[model samples]
Target: MSKRYTPREMLEKLISFNTVSDRSNLDLITFVETYLAEYGVTSIRVPDETGTKAALHAHIGPSEDGGVVLSAHTDVVPVKGQAWSQDPFASWVSNGKLYGRGSADMKGFAATVLAKVPDFIAADLQRPIHIALSYDEEVGCFGAPPLVRDMLAKGPRPSFAIVGEPTNMKVVTAHKGIAVYKTTITGHPAHSSQLHRGVSAISAAAKLISWLDAQTADNKAKADPDNAFEPPYTTLHSGVIKGGEAHNITAQHCEFITDFRLLPGDSKEAWLEAYRTFIDSQVLPDMQAISGDCGIEVEELAYVPGLSEEADGLAETEARGLTGDNARHVVVYATEGGIFQEHGVSTVVCGPGSIDQAHQADEFIELVELDRCAAFLDRLIGRLS
Candidate 1:
């Protein structure tokens, strides 16, 4: 009899852990660590320098060069203000789908990976089967850097990474990287009649937004572009904006967030420079001129780099064969694969559910998909052998 945990059972267990992105994922990490220990596996916890969160790396097979890594994030986005038929922390399987907060954006993948440990341990493996469970991936991919740094500082890199981010098990090779930023526009509040006496933070916000408009309009000139992405290009957008208390007075402060998902080979500095130039050339001068203390500034809150789909060689061929797909794809969502690729590990994103159902109310994954993924893993094991 197989010791592997069933897909539904894995989904339930994963949902039971509230690994929200902002909160510590230590509970989830502890659960996985305990689970892995049961199989007699030793792992490393690469904690973020702040010591608040950590990512895990465990190898269950032979220690050798060019092995494979199955990776996923342990954190899920918050469930605040979302309506659900079932509890976000407790999973429900109904109408043939498992529903939970991380059910699709993918605790499902993590569960599957953990369940298959017995399979991996039982095999006569010649190479390592590494489990890379990361933290804080939803908050601009912050938790993955420490683990990536750990891999970098440690010798012996893996050959490929399978970022299990719910592509319905299709192979994805490229995606746009998203670097998020928050800008602060500080201005003096004065009587509405005295417009010139106090600079309008909203107006300053407009200046910054105009630059973003120009950047979006001018993204046509990137190094390489893939039409497969919805926009067929990198994109920059302002997410949140806040300023005045009432319409009567000049707004004292304004703040907003920006998201930049860059195309492959597109330099991050170049994208950021466009907005910096706008702030320097336009917004700051007027604000500073109004009052010596007035100013506008930007800071990166989070960054997740896009993965280019240029890797289509022997290793990719091996992944393709394992999953029984002769073709490859590009995922619109972001993952740690780009970071892994940056560190000399080839990566392909293939997993068990559709991203369409992820990160929303009543998030779910079809049980059939999980079963298919388990079969896919079995195929991978056979091919590796």
Candidate 2:
């Protein structure tokens, strides 16, 4: 007989694995596979190109169309540089809160879903329930597309997908999208005295960064006050910059990372095109005039599409019905719900814990949150049955 674990025990087991975004989550994946197999639930593993990481999906109940998908990510941000009260990978309960690296940022929801697997199996479900756990959601939503693709191809189509992101168990209908870019500027080097002869890549980079800041400021200024998002506008930011070697010498190369968090209905392509046009028409010409070899390159590092509120979305309706939450909610952070929604699965973000506690030292989830989530799952099971 398979060992049964309560939600807390399962959370402890999951948190014990150091499945940081940079590290392999295969161990966790293997454990999940084994646990599910013990209960006769077969799972599919969609491995990354390196096979060092993977995404897992499984279906329970009758294999039929219009099932519901419980989506969660297995990876957590690194614990380095943060002063934690205890081991981040070791689960602990104190003051009625569960403390761990991924307790709130997600693994909480995954654990809850896993703990209820037997209940789902035991229930005579009229519609199936699909479990999807993805990797590399922190760095970017890198692991979800293939997982979604494989799950759809192998199993019956799901009518709705609930991405268990930390939302305090509230039904979130929309979220911002994100696109990361790396811009490299090459310029002719010269002595500081001959300013005209050598184009300063650092100078060009500053101008470009300034342009991004100006655009962000403009967006903020024109933003609607009544918009649900906190900022209520698209945001562009450059967090990392590296270039200058010496104070006197004109920097030959400068590189920076620019990321855009765009509200729903905004076009990433349009923004990218406009940025490129500015660089090619204005920035590059000045540098190339100084030296023919001077150049600029912009590469897209990652992209996660934004989730838009769907018209009468089944996921939202079902989640609202289960939780009895009627308030409108939209988040600024990007989640894999966008990916699912893109694939025609009506998706909503609803799960245990608060996003406020996610990715911080002493990250934790209130015990009552887990209880509420369990109750929500029970309702879902009842509805499906």
Candidate 3:
């Protein structure tokens, strides 16, 4: 088999696997594992509790301190209900663009690296190059932590990490952190005609959502004056809600899910605590007054940390040099850079394709963008060597 494949071919191999965030990524992992095995590259698997959805971590070159890592997620969002002229799982190229699920949001980055195996394996390098692929990144960013933790526990991790989520080949220094949660409100049920006899879970949820709305607006007002990002500060919004079985009968259950993207230096736990207190002091009391057993429960869906705001460091300098640009900016979308940074690894975000096309219908990555990504990896190999 040829060590070096083209970007289109590499992407086709990846797209064939239905590695949705909810499904196991073993097939994708197996393909990557087999490809790397041919080059004698060893890998470590970070398996989830169910023994599915493993994140593959591998390093090429010497396993010493101060190496660099190229990172991309393996999971793709569901294609259901999306309007796509072509099969979302089949790679299609038209007018110098490749279209498929995960084409731009990521898999493009993964494919570009895989396509350049010859360049990496053939290079006589002084420092190592690590490839870290994770799962479940599209669904609340619920992957990559265990792999990162496992790497740190062994010894010093890489010095720099490049989270390749689509930046059109530019260097992104900062992004907001995400804290997701689900709340279930429980209350007694009775006939709607006798409203005062039993508690209403729907009413409690309404009050809680109202408080969250006010808090979200306040956070928006107190946002930092950074024009680099779209929202410019921490933002909050609800994604899912369920309640009320019948109009005439009193509903006994209500569940809602919310997401808060925190700015740098903000505390996720503090925000959660305040929300719980608001429910306990304000909404819970009113409900419990009607029924002694009324209660509310909150569960953490996922927590992805915000990228560090500071960027005047080695990673930034090197990224600028490799990309042949001195201008750097911040993005509002989250990435795995923060997770890697927390483990004492200097991380940055740079990749091919524009983020505007990510997670959208009929997504694509331009041929020129894939070329640029391959060139970036090539330049990175030269720089490390």
Candidate 4:
């Protein structure tokens, strides 16, 4: 007979996949589908355009009425530069902590859900339970929209979705939206001595970056006093910039990637439009004056909208009842909770572990946190049954 595995054992198996955002999550998806199949639950796969990655959606119990969904992402961030004491893909336990890449951020939640599959199967539930697993979330939440769209199109749409995004079992009702963009500047190249003959792309990029800094500061100054988010304002910054080969030559091309986090009810389009206008009217015109071919291109890379507090209290109430927490938090990070909310699902974020441990070297989740999550799920199962 096959040995029955606990949540920790299942998490050990999940950690072995190495489902980094850049790599395909097909192997992990297959493992989950096969595991669910053994318990007589069939999952629906929504594949990305390339067919290399997919999101899995499955429902257990009566599907006639709207039910609750447990949401999680399958991908883990890369550990390329992070220093780890052991293999990041192979989990280990020491001093009451489970250490691995996705151990805390959050294969732990997925494992807890899977570990309770037997209980879910045996329970006589009046309402269904949903399991939503997606790919490539660490990159930019790229995998959630398609999966959510598929869920909406199909019948028995979930009324509430609980995104397990490692809130240390606290219920989080709101989080900031994220918008990412890449801006490229092209210019005429000329030798350093003939600087006037060339439009320096790097110089133009520098000015734009400086302008972004000023704009960010202005944003900080204009924060709404009533906003609940930290700093009570939308924030922006550029993370990557690239240009130029040597000091002797003017760079012909320069590029930088920037992103902003928006408070709920803030207008993302308004901010993006203002930046685009500045690029077109100020940056491009100056470049064009030096060289007609010189130009600037701004492209939107990814967007994940914020989860608003406007959601009806159904999910929040359920989560609070399960965890016995009366307070709700507004987080600084983004999650699939936003996407679910935007698509008309009342969503709340609650899970084990801490965001502080996420994407860090030697990332680990406390065994106590896992136990808490298991108990929370047990309460959820009891309520559903």
Structural similarity to truth (TM-score) of each candidate: 0.93, 0.99, 0.96, 0.96
Which pairs of residues clash in candidate 3, taking residues 3 or more apart in a chain or in different chains? none
Off-target runs (Cα >4 Å) in candidate 3 are: 1-3
Instruction: For model 1, name the residue pairs that clash.
Output: 176-306, 177-305, 177-306
Q: Which candidate comes out best when scored by lDDT? A: 2
Compared with the true structure, the alpha-carbon lDDT of candidate 2 equals 0.94
**What is the descending TM-score order?**
2, 4, 3, 1
Worst 10 residues of 4 by lDDT: 1-10
Of 1 and 3, which scores higher on TM-score?
3
What residue pairs clash in candidate 4, if any at all? none
> Residue 128 lDDT in model 1?
77
TM-score of candidate 2 to 2 decimals = 0.99
* Model 4 TM-score on a 0 to 1 scale: 0.96
Model 3 over residues 202-236: C-alpha lDDT tens digits? 88888888888898889778766855677876676
Q: Tell me which residue pairs clash in candidate 2.
A: none
Candidate 1's residue-wise lDDT over 220-274, tens digit each? 5652453777677777889899888679789989999988878767777887887
Instruction: Quickly count the clashes in candidate 3.
Output: 0
Per-candidate alpha-carbon RMSD to the true structure: 2.3, 0.7, 1.6, 1.5
